[model samples]
Target: MNIKLLAVGKTDNESLQKLIDEYIKRLGFYINFNLEILPDIKNAKNLSEAQQKEKEGELILKKIQSADVLILLDEKGKQYTSEEFSGYLQKKMNSGAKQLVFVIGGPYGFSDEVYKKSSGKISLSKMTFSHQMVRLFFVEQLYRGFTILRNEPYHHR
Candidate 1:
């Protein structure tokens, strides 16, 4: 199954971008993985937190396909061990899914609509992280998961 990561905004730090790129390249060896960035909203000052979430939610929902399995990266979501996450990814692939998409929502988090649309949520950590930083962390873990799946040395490194 194809795996896609959709996140709001771009990663601006050169150092972070380098690391994210490395993980993305590594992940590509295992699956059809693509990291898509949605442009950040401009002049967000006028929008309330909920309104921002709603707007971002709409954008997030639009990127999804009817058959795609949607997963959200949420702080309050189910947290999994690395092995469990690997198994989860394996199950989705085994089920013959066309595509599996994971989204990292904007600052205020997801709207109710987005929550309803998702099949599941995976939390990387209980602590909060910057939206941009989460992209790197998520991509790196994805690479690690794939490595473990293949019994590669990278996972242990």
Candidate 2:
């Protein structure tokens, strides 16, 4: 199965981008992983929080296909340990998921429509992190998850 990460805006910090790139390359060895960055909305200062989320939602939805399993990186979603997350990844592949799409929403969060469209949600941590930072964390965790599944030396109990 293909794994796609959909996030709004680019990572402006060079160091963070470098780390994110490293994980992306590592992930390629185990699975077909794609990172799609949707451009941030222009004139966002003029829009209300709800409107901004709505506009971002439209862009997010456009990238999703009918068969894709849409999962959001939401703050309130269920949390899992590294081993459990590896099991979750294995389950998706076993279930014949074509594409597993995990989205990191904009600064204001996701729209109601986006929430309704999501098949499930996952929380990386209880405390919030910047959207850009979340991309790196999520990608690295994904790589670690795959390593755990394959019995690689990358992860340890």
Best-matching candidate per TM-score: 2
Candidate 2 error regions (>4 Å)? none
Model 2 lDDT at residue 76 = 90
Clashes of 2: 0
Candidate 1 deviant stretches above 4 angstroms: none
> Distance (Å) between predicted and true CA of 84, model 2?
0.5
lDDT of prediction 2: 0.96
Give the per-residue lDDT digits (tens) of candidate 1, residues 1-157.
8999999998889899999999998887889999999988777789999899989998999999999999999998899887788888889999999999999999888999999999999999999999879999999888888888888888777
Residue 149 of model 2, lDDT score: 98
Q: How many pairs in model 1 have backbone atoms within 3 A of each other, for residues 3 or more apart or on separate chains, i.e. clashes?
A: 0
Q: Pick the candidate with the highest lDDT.
A: 2
lDDT of each: 0.91, 0.96
* Candidate 2 local lDDT, 11-67, one digit each (tens): 999999999999999999999999999999999999999999999999999999999
TM-score of each: 0.97, 0.98
